[model samples]
Target: MRPVIPYLVSAGLFGLGVFGLLRRRNAVLLLMAVELMLNAVNLLLVTADTTVRAALPHSGQVFALFVIVLAAAEVGVGLAIVLRLFRLRADIDVDAIALTGPDATVALAATSPSLTSPTCGTPSATPGAAQ
Candidate 1:
């Protein structure tokens, strides 16, 4: 069918975005992957609108418009959060924030000591504690 090409391309783009989102640790790269996923969905909606018989009164176009608005909002909020994080830590590595390892968790906890307690200091003898 004539619409198959666009649908396949959209699917591929969505898959690529998913892969990038999962594999990349950079905040900017993650945002780009999100954009790619949004574009892919837009393309699929437009293609469906054009190919389907008895056209459905431009509902797809309306949906696409809402998606664009949502994407813009997402980008704005996401960038603001990323900027704040960068200001605080000076880096944009998503993996760094995960802090899955015990060492990482302890190090983060030590660095961010409680405001009301001076005794909440760095771990003195924990093995593998981050420097």
Candidate 2:
């Protein structure tokens, strides 16, 4: 019932969320850290609604609800992206994720002459056309 308890709790939650986000390497744990951050904000909003600002009664609660909804959508899309990443790479460690494979661009450049070729998009020979 202490007046400062809510503030302390919210601050602790936020701090833990930030720590988890920075420390975790797995994709799912990273997502959970983001959820922790969202929940911390929600708790702060509700605390302010009930105690600090009597003028605006339920506004903070309403905003908290919106945050919850946004967090839900974020989880859905985030998980799907993580699942796709897992399918492609067979691992979910964020440190292993890269914008491109180590040899992907180099292999493409080596095989495709289009970079310097005059007729890039057109194939050099038509298989069934008359010679």
**How many clashing residue pairs, candidate 2?**
0
Q: How many angstroms is residue 5 displaced in model 1 relative to the true structure, after the best TM-score fit?
A: 0.3
Worst 10 residues of 1 by lDDT: 114-123
Provide the overall lDDT of each model, using Cα atoms, as 2-decimal numbers: 0.82, 0.82
Local accuracy of candidate 2 as per-residue lDDT tens digits, 2-91: 547987899999999999999999999999999999999999998888885669879989999999999999999999999987865677
lDDT of 2: 0.82
Taking every candidate in turn, the Cα RMSD to the unseen true structure, in Å, is 5.1, 7.2
TM-score, one value per model: 0.76, 0.75
Kindly report which residue pairs in candidate 1 clash with one another: none
Model 1 scores a C-alpha lDDT of 0.82
Off by over 4 Å in 2: 100-131
Model 2: how far residue 68 lies from native, Å: 0.3
Model 1 lDDT per residue over 12-121, tens place: 99999999999999998999999999999999988887777376867778888998999999999999989987875678898778556566655455545532222454
